[model samples]
Target: MEGGLLFQFCNWSTLLVCMVIKVPQIFALLSAKSSRGVSLKSLLLELAGFLVFLRYQSYYSYPLLTYLEYPILIAQDVILLLCVFHYNGSMNQAIPYIAVFLGGWYLLALQKWIIDLAMNLCTFISAASKFAQLQYLWEARDSGAVSALTWSLSAYTCATRVITTLMTTQDLMVLVRFLIMLALNIWVTATILRYRKTATKDE
Candidate 1:
């Protein structure tokens, strides 16, 4: 009974966290009126990873609680993406991105092998997203519009998912993906904090 309760807590908490996961970052962008430190490539890659993972879970009929937060995460990402494009004054470029994402979504489930392959690659794709952001931070030397709070919350969600995935699916692929994501999220959060401190010191 205690284990069940813990599972529920982790699942529900992950959902709650994801519901507002991107709000801080979105607010940061709007407040700064710039996408300076935000990486569009990272955002796009992250969104793709989310889509692939969500579809894979659904296709395999995993427990709803195990993957429930993904839709919320994806929606938040879409809003965040729009904000990035708006601030970058490249809203027109968003069309191709949307088209590709939609197309890829439909194609992922076209065959079992495709999604299996995608799931295997999902970890790397997601990891790449993190590295992309880290690269941007390293290059820009500023956290300008990147919210450390958002990344910290993301790490929290990933940690909870790691627990929940072990409790429920126990799928090795899913477990590994969450583990990688948790690590990457923590790394990104730390990088953002370090850059923020440097920016403050330079001020």
Candidate 2:
């Protein structure tokens, strides 16, 4: 019973912390007023992955806590995408893409075979999204729009999730997912530190 309670504590705490970690990234994007170092492709791919996971969780009847967490992540990714559009003064251009994304998300959940395929594909895309962001960072090594604090928090969240997941669930897919996230976040954190200027010039 005590072990179960401890597992519950770690699970809730990790999810809660991960959810909170996005707030700063949102604010950072807003404050910088640019998404110069961010990868829009990565954000879009990650958004799709989030939607897939949310639907999968719903389909399989995951715990309510897990169900609730994905929406928060989805919302944050949407906000991040909007920030990108807002900074680029291309809100008009974003509408169609947003519509398409939502449309695809809705349609994907309807077919079980598609869902299974998307589940695997989205997982791979989600992991690859980090590399996409890393590629963007490499391309824009002169800029410091990517927030170190945000990525650091993300790394911490991923690490926490990995540990808690290993201890509690021991599910391979979930374990691998968070492990990749943790590694990518650490790489981002290091890249940020390496390239970040003491005072970044505005783009």
Looking at model 2, residue 156 earns an lDDT score of 75
lDDT string for model 1 (1-203, tens) is 99999999998988888889999999999999999999999999999999999999999999998888899999999999999999988999999999999999999999999999999999999999999999999999998889999999988988888898888778999888888888999999999999889989998
Top TM-score prediction, candidate number: 1
On lDDT, the candidate that comes out on top is 1
CA lDDT of 71 in candidate 2? Answer: 81
> What lDDT does candidate 2 reach at residue 117?
78
Q: Which ten residues in a row have the lowest lDDT in candidate 1?
A: 161-170
Q: What TM-score, over all chains together, does every model reach?
A: 0.98, 0.86
For model 1 the local lDDT of residue 120 reads 95
Q: What residue runs in model 1 are displaced by over 4 Å at the alpha carbon?
A: none
Q: Per-residue lDDT of 93-155 in model 2, one digit per residue for the tens?
A: 889987987898788778898877777676688878888888887887743567778788778
